[model samples]
Target: MLRYEMQGGIWVYPGKGGWHFITLPTDVAARIKAAMAGLARPWGSLGVTAVIGKTKWTTSLFPDKTTGSLLLPVKASVRQSERLKAGDAPIVTIEIAL
Candidate 1:
């Protein structure tokens, strides 16, 4: 298992109820690509357990071609639980298992 903790700002997608996301740092994304690229699922999504504040959930991290980073989707439930909104920067912990 590998664990990473980082802080990033949340952003909302333009349409379709506005999906929220947090982009992983470029360095961290590169590290993950090196270590876990073979473990990725379809669309380059990697399974992970994410925690923000006291809220935790299982989800997938998707690679972003535009930014060369990884994107973590922040579900509405988790956002409500963590009291987070788009534009807020929060410390998040993600655990990946092999």
Candidate 2:
């Protein structure tokens, strides 16, 4: 089996749409557009805009090697309360499996 660190939360996006969680990576971004695109619900296509994150990014790892997890809900997803919050975006996060 493959081992993963969970690292932190991730944000799956669909262009102008809100961000969702396809399947957060461990210590890397989706690797490529196809990474998440392939696993998307329908499969064979992810016709959004772009995804720029992985594993709960933060200022600590910006520019060079950021945390790399772009998981966020552009609009309503933020107002879900407790689960999410609206503000200046999120970055820098860590998580591990149980």
* lDDT at position 28, candidate 2: 51
Model 1 global lDDT (CA atoms, 0 to 1): 0.92
lDDT of 2 by residue, 24-66 (tens): 3423545433244433433223223322233232111111123
For 1-98, candidate 1 gives per-residue lDDT tens digits of 88899999999988898899999999988887787868989998988999999998999999999999999999999999988999999999988887
What are the runs in model 2 whose C-alpha is more than 4 Å off?
1-7, 12-14, 26-41, 44-79, 86-98
Off by over 4 Å in 1: none
Residue 63 error for model 1, in Å? Answer: 0.9
Candidate 1 at 98: error in angstroms? 1.4
lDDT values for all models: 0.92, 0.32
TM-score attained by model 1: 0.95
